[model samples]
Target: MVNERDPDAGTEHWLDLGPDPDLDSDPRHPGGWRWWSLLVAAMAVAALLLTQNQRATHPLPGTDPAGASVTRSASVAARPLPESHSPPRRTGSPLSGQSLSGMLFGASPAPTAVEPAGAQASAVSVTDLGHPLLAVPAGWELFGQGPGIVVRIELGRGRVTRTSVPEVGSASPIFFVVGHDRAIVHPMDSVPGYVVRDGKPATQLPPALDQAASALPGPDPWHLWAETETGTATALSLLTLDGRPAGVQVPIPKDATVQASDRAGNVLMFGIGGMYDLRQDGMHRITGGTLLAVGPTRWLTLECDESYRCDSVVIDRATGARQTVKASLDAYEQNAGAISPDGRTAALLQPNGIGASTVHLLDLSTGADRLTGVTTSSDQTLGGRTFVWSPDSRWLFVTNGAGRVLAIDRAGRAISLDVHVGAIDQLALRTTRR
Candidate 1:
């Protein structure tokens, strides 16, 4: 009835219910709803902050979804290096720039030095010792050291027992090959072939092999290839580790000198008849030259012209394929190339004719050669130097003319060992598996 005709008529209806309940309240002050809204906003902010802290404490398990690889990489960079069975790197003086690339004369700066051996440098360099001897590899021990022959026998736990050979002298340096537990000895003079184990005579070879001129490691870890002279001609005899004959005797020329025996026990010999394969009893009548290398799949021979400069011919034993490689010749000697164990790289010596010998590295696949600037401190002789390949084919151990032992890599980088193993007339590696 109050709002029947006027706009103020409905005002009393609303005003009558409230009755100015907050009339005593300040007009500038916020009400209860405003305070409640602020309290709710504070609680929400606290919940958001707690969720962020929890994520920081426990990250996701797998890859990061935030694309923060750079930050994660920093954490991994603090870890240690992995373990390997390689020789410790050396931190001695840097090498001189001595690598020559035929077309390029000057040497390049040497590679950065590796970490020092530190606490693990157990390889004692014994230059002061009077015994002219070589130590076994890292895990083996020198079983014996003597005037002409040194023997190394492996102990069970990667150790070795060293012993000396009797009746061997410097007058006739012993030529031998090491097997599993035994070594076959062939004295360059009148001594007969004998098998020695732990420094004692295990047994003697058959009468046919008594005149063995050379013995090579082969057939297996327990067999050796004895290049014997049968008075009338030369023959190849396969002998067991204990000196017993193991295979059919293959006959070679009387003057044939065995250069190398392949992994399959195939013998490569060179003589007045050129190159010959004793395994197949066939002659490689390519040219009269000296065999320089014998690889797993190939054999390298060098033929010289009137100037004494030589050409290297690599022949594939299986396929009879031949590849001729040309490089700077040393013009001084007959045999100097060494085919790596992996058959990928070759180390050649270009004797300077005076006394210093320049060494070079050749890539088998590309025929590219690099001068390693490695020099032997003596005149290049027919024998007395040593160039042996490491089991892994990554290193070459060379006994220079100056009598210093050096361990060189395929890149021609060298590390000199402070030891004198004497004039290595005949050298053999300790080939036992560790």
Candidate 2:
């Protein structure tokens, strides 16, 4: 009802329901409504916050992150691994210097020493023996008792112990000649090839005896040019020991030299021109003039049945069997041959060539332990004169037709001597290998 103000300016309005009601007593006041609304809104906010916190604390199942590896907290399934492909090592081979590597390793192995059949005994000194028999290698080489004497096979010569060769032309006929070690002294074509045991002048043989002594094929093998009045000189017998038979007759061409007896008698003579091996009781025909003694074994004058270059054969002594093996000379040298004490190797003795005459040895599969030369000398005669090994394999006696008696100790060194008598036809060392 009052004067109307400008329309742009609105008039403030306030309504008063009651004059001064006690606000604490009032239940439905405008202020009350506002306070109730705030309380309800704050409670709603708190509830919503709690729900969000719970969700953030833990994510729901069935949801996994991308690119996660499958990690195993425990052991994995059994399967072949590349690292396990290695072979298990041998117990002995590991420490045998075979080049095996592992965290756990051991020591190297030792060699096997296979000695001959005799009961092991200490050897005797050469000085103890009276007669100035040829000296020899000591130890396992030769066993001595009354002295290392080459017992004379003939009763007449048996009493003659002194190795003193009579004056040249004195006519003390010498039926036996031996080369002590590599030294040769004998009465052959008679030129007096007498070398003493002390390197002194023993005596002299006739020119014929000298010629015969000098004619020996030095260190290579027994090469007797083959001359005979009967049967075309079929076989050349070896005279190893003083007491041995003249020698085993090695049949020529039709009957080859099958068994080579030692020059001194019986030392080592087996499997030469041998037949039948691998298969039992077998036999083969040996060519005539086909077999000849080379060195330890037989050197073939003829080729194998197949016409191959073969020189080695294994003989079954009981069955008289033979088996021919074709291989290089070195093969024989390393396996079959035993090196002499003086240092001359069987290999050096026999070089492969046309018309080569040589001597060789063939030990059973036991393998060869070669002897190394002590001194440096090329002359086979000066070094190893092919001292024959005794059948007993116990002694190594030296024979130089000149009469310097030498002995060999299979376990020690070879000794030199100044003594003599009839030239040694051949000599042998005793065998221990049974």
- Return the TM-score for candidate 2, rounded to 2 decimals: 0.30
Model 1 clash number? 6
TM-score of each: 0.54, 0.30
Model 2, residue 154: C-alpha shift (Å): 16
Residue 14 of model 2, lDDT score: 53
Predictions in order: lDDT: 0.54, 0.32
Model 2 has how many clashing residue pairs? 97
lDDT winner: 1
Q: Which stretches of candidate 1 lie over 4 Å from their true place?
A: 1-162, 166-174, 192-213, 228-234, 254-264, 280-287, 303-311, 330-332, 354-358, 373-385, 401-404, 417-423
Q: lDDT per residue, candidate 2, 1-434, as tens digits?
A: 12455567686545556654345555666367556766776667566756755654554553223223333211112111112221222223212433222212333445433333321121111122333233222212221111112222211111122233323342322223333422234433332444222222233323333433222221212222111113444333333322122333333334332232223222221233442111111223333223322333332222344565455443333354555544334322221233333222222234334432233332323224233222211112211233444433433444434444454455435565433433443443322221
- Please report the TM-score between candidate 1 and the true structure: 0.54
Candidate 2 lDDT for residue 370 = 31
